[model samples]
Target chain A: MSVAGSDFAVRVEGLEKSFGHWPVLWDLDLTLDWGQLLVLFGANAVGKTTLLRILSTQARPDAGTLSVAGYDPVRTPNAVRRRIGVVGHQTCLYDDLTCRENLVYYGRLFGLTDIPRRVDEAISRVSLGHRADQRVRTLSNGMQKRASIARAILHRPPLLLLDEPEAGLDQESTVMLQGLLKEWAESGGAAIMTTHNVDLGLAWGETGKIGVLADGKVQVQEPGRYANVAEFRQVLSSSLVTRQRN
Target chain B: MVLVWKDILLEVRSRELVISVLVFGLLVAVVFNFALDVTPQRVTAIAPGILWVAFAFAATMAMSRAFVREREQGGLEGLLLSPVSRDAIFLGKALTNLLFMLLVEMVLLPVFAVLFGFSAMSFTLIGTIVLATLGFSLVGTLFSAIAAQTRSREIMLPVLFFPVILPVIIGAVEASTRAIGGETTVGLGRWLPLLAVFDALFLVICPWVFSFVVEE
Candidate 1:
């Protein structure tokens, strides 16, 4: 099937997926424009990673009408993969390889020209130039996350699909992420990051949209509409409580 | 076995996997030499079986580790997320596994020669090794990727591996025996062409199947 919109970074309608008998996501609809940032918040096991996996072409939806970067994920996965970058809980860097080596490897995989220059630029972009020579196993969690971010943007992809990018980040790494996100917005590239921290999620989309996945569907709102974080927290707790009750 | 990644991963890799395969192969040769009592008359028959068994089992065990690093470090997802064709990913990995298995086989061949009382060097035996290793390594590499995704990968690999590679095991043994016996036409001529056919067939099928195996 042909994608209707050429502008949306991601568009999903009535997406459904399940593991065995447990339904993780059903009839879920969401969209992110190329110039917007979307922060997706959900409780543990609420299919946050599953949704991101579908978008990244790592997992297939049981049923859905979906388009990522104007390409159907299953029909044209390579095209979709080319248009997107992904960062999950794992660093995706080889432990045996140095940080610079990891970026250069990805640069070659993505068929980027001027690889040494791109690797240098990406390493510097994440402020990993000093430690770029070290193997990934030697780096701390924060440094690895920074290197992962470098790998993600090594191809200069138009969209970034991040799954809980802030889970264990320290203050410095978190601050580095904020700068990256700010630059991500400024570059007009789209991003959909799954996060559990309400404050962090809301902060990610400062002026953009924040979404909550509950009962197999998402309810999105502009954080600007809420008076403070507590309001959004109340709504989130109430919805999750309602789900648990059912 | 080695990783594929456009051959760049070779530079970063440690020597552990190579050492593992070589040592495992030599262990098989040593055990077989002590376990069996073979004179020159039986050497042609029994030695070929022992040699291929060493190569097949050792290569199977070693090739399974090829994807462990990728899966454990979550780098497989990174590869899947790339714009590179899935077929290229599979072929590159299968070919690299082939390369590594050949390297270990070269190291072990002389050891097997001393143990089994056979000539160390023969073009026909080398040809048989290359063709047969290619077939099994392609199948092994594909199964490694599949088994790596599952929870009981260790159990899954052998359960899935031995049955599929039985043909290569038989073909290599037959061809190696003929190559060692200096029969230029009878068994080697028949088995070599057949082994090449199987290699070509696996070379085509494994990569295509690998695309689906990696998908969720």
Candidate 2:
């Protein structure tokens, strides 16, 4: 399907990833365009994080082609990595360093100049300016999550991948995070966030696409479209009942 | 280049690795002072071996902690996702570890001089320290990266590192011993070349091996 401004930020065709004998992502085909927010929904072990890792060039697909910003992730991972930022269950921040120090450290990793300014801007953007100098280990979970988000965006990568970014966040932090994500999308950055919160996903549905992944495949790709909320709830309930019976 | 500098800067701030290594090297030097007592004439003969053993043990201690900070805070994945070359990561980490090892040697040199009553400040001894520590850190950093990924990483680091780095330690200690003894024998010449060869071999191999260790 042709997306508006069809210049895709991330595109994968027949991407297959497996560990030993167990397949995690099987023949998965996905495309995400710039300026779009894509929320991927999947049950645990459905390959959501695996797909994100492969897209971010942190892991290689066993078969087929995957590209981020037109560079093949496996063959040209560094080039792909330059354009992608990832925040996963792993905060990927040094606990000994202050939040600002962590961002500055990552900024240098990206070979970014004007690191102080970039770090300052990211800290302000994440609304953690007051706590920038606090060690990451000392921060609360919500604060640490914000610091992680700041670090991920320090270089302003065009593509952002977040795996369960809202896992331990409070309601207020979740709202703030959602607002930041909306701003990032509005500013022409593409994001793919995985979450189990259907309500949060629905909040983003107006300007975002949704994919339901199950059993190592994208079972549905409904873009800016979801079945009626009540009907979806009913379907979900029946599926849970079926699972319980089995 | 940037990542390497970052690690160096971070090390400068914390100084944990360097301090631990320096203290450990001094402790080893003290222990060796009594364990390998020698006549004044033989003091120079045994100095290099003692220095290297101290440096290698201290370096391994520091290298194992290189990733501990990253692993504890989950920053390794962030590093792996960056555009930096894997070789740069390996070199940066190994160089920082080497720098800490050098710091340890710096402290040990004076202590050895005072304890053994023989100066180890000669240019040859200094050169040996530089070369030997490079070889030691190269192997230590690579094995430390591997150990960080496994269970019981603390215990596993030295267990895995000591066996694999036997050649480097032997080559380095032999070269240092020969240089200290003021013996320009052909065998001494062979040790220097052998130390250089091992350093070069590890420098080339560790970066490639590090990529596999960091891969998800």
* DockQ (CA atoms), all models: 0.63, 0.59
List, residue by residue over B5-57, the lDDT tens digit for candidate 1.
Answer: 53436423777778888888888877887788777888998999889889988
lDDT of 1 at B87: 84
Candidate that scores best on DockQ = 1
- Candidate 1 CAPRI category: medium
Q: What range of 10 consecutive residues in model 2 chain A has the weakest lDDT sum?
A: A237-246
Candidate 2: pairs in clash: none
TM-score of chain A of 1: 0.92
- Alpha-carbon error at A94 in model 2, in Å? 2.1
DockQ of 2: 0.59
Model 2 lDDT tens row, A17-85: 899988788878888777888887776666788888888887878998776776888888888787777
